[model samples]
Target chain A: MSDPSSLLGALRVVLVGTSHPGNIGGVARAMKNMGLKDLRLVAPRAQFPHPEAEFRASGATDILNDVVVNDTLEEALADRTLVAGTSARSRHLPWPLLNPRELAGRLQDELRQPEHRIALVFGREDRGLSNEELQLCHLHVHIPTNPEFSSLNLAAAVQVLSYEVRMALVEQAETASRKEDQPFGTEWDAPLATSESLERFFEHLEKTLVDIEFHDPNNPRKSLSRLRRLYLRARPDSNEINMLRGILTSTQKAAGTKK
Target chain B: MSDPSSLLGALRVVLVGTSHPGNIGGVARAMKNMGLKDLRLVAPRAQFPHPEAEFRASGATDILNDVVVNDTLEEALADRTLVAGTSARSRHLPWPLLNPRELAGRLQDELRQPEHRIALVFGREDRGLSNEELQLCHLHVHIPTNPEFSSLNLAAAVQVLSYEVRMALVEQAETASRKEDQPFGTEWDAPLATSESLERFFEHLEKTLVDIEFHDPNNPRKSLSRLRRLYLRARPDSNEINMLRGILTSTQKAAGTKK
Candidate 1:
């Protein structure tokens, strides 16, 4: 599998009908802090690239400069495989409602497919995504705020959700590294030997053993079968299998001298 | 354990030498959204009741209204039983440094005593808390952010930490019936090969290798043992081992025909 940043980079943060330009700037800063670069605005109410936004962005103006403006949320999420909408209330929707942590876990699973892209959609400041917008998303994410005061600042909401995504990626990388320590991970230098290459190796191996007089044709034994099992268990990489084949060639040459 | 709101209400948010009045309002909003009400300021540069702070506070003006101002950090955390300071860097300090999530877990354990009062202090906007001030706290809490772009907005930092606190409290309430689930180690399509199947494959393999003149009978070079090691590492499932045995049978037939 690829690095966690690869997954983070594939995530698209879409803001729909954001009323305040300052919140846009704050979202940029929050996204940059968590290593998320993709930012899309769908029909923003205020003028972007405004001084207030740049000031709020602090030093993440680069994110603002590169922001993509889409006329509709559908265009922003057209290429995305998974779309998750942020909601302050989970009870109102009959759809799947996940807390931020659960959302992160789901995203990690979805990103296992290399080409998969994810979009985390946030709605307007005063009101969240409309029913139509919510229906477009596969799942709804709730930040689990105080019920009485659940109105999270637009940027603050982005910060919390993005932070969870980053944490999830970090944890995934850590788990992969831990599996490497256990000697079972695919993070090795070379790819495993394919079935075709392994078949060729076995053919060459059997021929050489017969030529070298190590294996008797008239009186067959179980040695060849045992050796086949051993090779299969070892799961030799392509390079290792080539090296074994070379050794078989040398053995064949020596046996030819006797003939 | 006490109710989450009770612990949240008992917790104090102290801002030290904060220069921006707007950020103060942002902090108040973040705190209120997470069910934290106690707000204290230590020698703030901007006016406490500034219009900008009120504007940014949104509807969280109640939290800003009850904010306590103190002359020094000491006065601000005088009554608090536990103190956790926010830091961007966790390396330099010799004191206990915990990530936001870990800090929340520790705080949950510490807050078990109903009489306990905890203080989460934020330093100046530009320089953060002075080393001397950090020394006064029990531990440092670092929000894990992208190392390349680690300048978190003041309010965003508060929002993230407060979000963690709220999540920790909510999770604590749900822990009684919660089951531990691993995020990785995806389920496999097939069960692993049984030892019996593996042994049968091994018997077929050894005979095939000998027949092909690859393995020497009179003067064996420990090839069987080496191959054993390699195959063991592969950990092929039953289907894979069966396919391997079939390959061995084909190799044996080809070698026999050549002889």
Candidate 2:
């Protein structure tokens, strides 16, 4: 029911505490390259309309001219449903990390929902995403540069992500156009399983397993997580998940256990 | 023989007929971001070390400082063995156009050889690589852009390509390092059929078919090509090919009586 081009409109490129105006200009041009328009700067240190930025932006002044600068990151991300932070370094605590390509695909999937707003947050050039800023984001995206010299230019990182988004949109458009004559893909018969449905199914499965003594609730090692990862990777559609849930219910009933 | 990081040394980012110094600066920043050092300018309309460029480069002054200026494209590319020209628009004559990722892989494959120098040439901001300039380069690299507004900022284009190269290098390094302990993959036991061996098998199979009057060579449509494609897709290993050849020999001997 949605077109990939509209996904661009749903995306917001947010810069937090950007020190250089030229980098901002560079990002604007990068966003324009991918047909992305929304630009939100969270308290930029440099002055806006700095002739240097305009001079550097080249033909993408349209993006810079319409740029939105907020006093804080929360204000910039107030309307965003999904926020992804860019980081080159690993965190002390493990967080779900996505490369640019995966982030683009996830963004496209999220945009399929009604009125979903996506924010791709980039942090300061020197220190990268702060722990507070990182925690606020739903996912962290790493561009994957050389380990020896992994200092990717901020604008270049933006360009890489913008390119990935453009590619994802183009792929979706092509797939849609190609499917015009006849519907394809095995999953076309069933809508993709919703997040809430998957969560419910996991809860039911866990309860049933614990009741049946198949899983130890107290000492539940990585088995549940492994299963979750497997299911997520398989990406079962609604019908498939429903069938599996039914099987789980039946299995629990046969075992004379309550879920 | 070479690591991905060394590839940067062998690569030269060449900009032709650049009108703005800021773009040159932007290119330098992009190059430096990806660990690329060599910057060659061919007949720039703007003066060298323009303050605007310095202002825009942020901290990549080392790249801008060591820039090589030439009056002609040929002079800039004289030392390079592999040259890839960047173009945004399609041309009258179809050239071997590769997207940034494919170009990066091809560059990596080419760089496997000793003393190989590669050049990534970008044309002016307004009109991309001229027909004459294109003819000189071995391949054309096109960054996939949004069709609605495909005007990619020159430096952004540089950033995208540079990022791809860096990613490709990192991926190669990872794959190499991962394979160090306990080698994997199903094909490790047997070497895959070489192109020459596959071609010979195809020729033999075709001759045997004609000998048995199964395929009329004179009126053959796409049968030969189709069979070639099928075998190629299968990607038979040495043992598989040998077994298939033995089966074909037996089948031919049995079909002689019918013929």
* TM-score per candidate: 0.68, 0.65
Provide C-alpha RMSD values for all models, in order.
Answer: 15.2, 16.9
Per model, the share of native interface contacts recovered reads 0.46, 0.32
10 residues in a row with least lDDT, candidate 1 chain A:
A177-186
Q: Mark the regions of model 2 whose C-alpha exceeds 4 Å error after superposition.
A: A1-4, A49-52, A147-149, A172-259, B1-3, B176-259
Question: Candidate 1 residues A1-259, lDDT tens each?
Answer: 3445556766889999998999999999999888888999999998986999998988888889999999988788776656788875643324456789988876765555544567899999999899767756656788877778889999999999999988877777766653222123445544556545666787787776666445433333444544454464455666568657855664454445333
How far in Å is the alpha carbon of A129 misplaced in model 2? Answer: 2.3
Per-residue lDDT over B1-259 for candidate 1, one digit per residue giving the tens place of the 0 to 100 score: 4447667877889999989999999999999889899999999998878999999999899999899899999999888889999886754758888888889988887766877889999999888999889988998998877777888888899898888888888888877645443111222334567788888887876766666566444345566665565666766655557656655655555455334
Measured with C-alpha atoms, the lDDT of residue B208 in candidate 2 is: 54
In order, what are the TM-scores of chain A for the candidates? 0.66, 0.67
lDDT of 2: 0.71
DockQ of each: 0.22, 0.14
**Model 2 pairs whose backbones collide:** none
Task: Categorize the docking of model 2.
Answer: incorrect
Compared with the true structure, what per-residue lDDT tens digits does model 2 show for residues A1-259?
A: 2434456755789998888887888788777767788999998888887886886566788889899889987677765656788976566433457778778777665555554567899989888888767655656788766555566667778888988887776667666653322112222455555545666777887775565444323335444543453354344456656655654564455444533
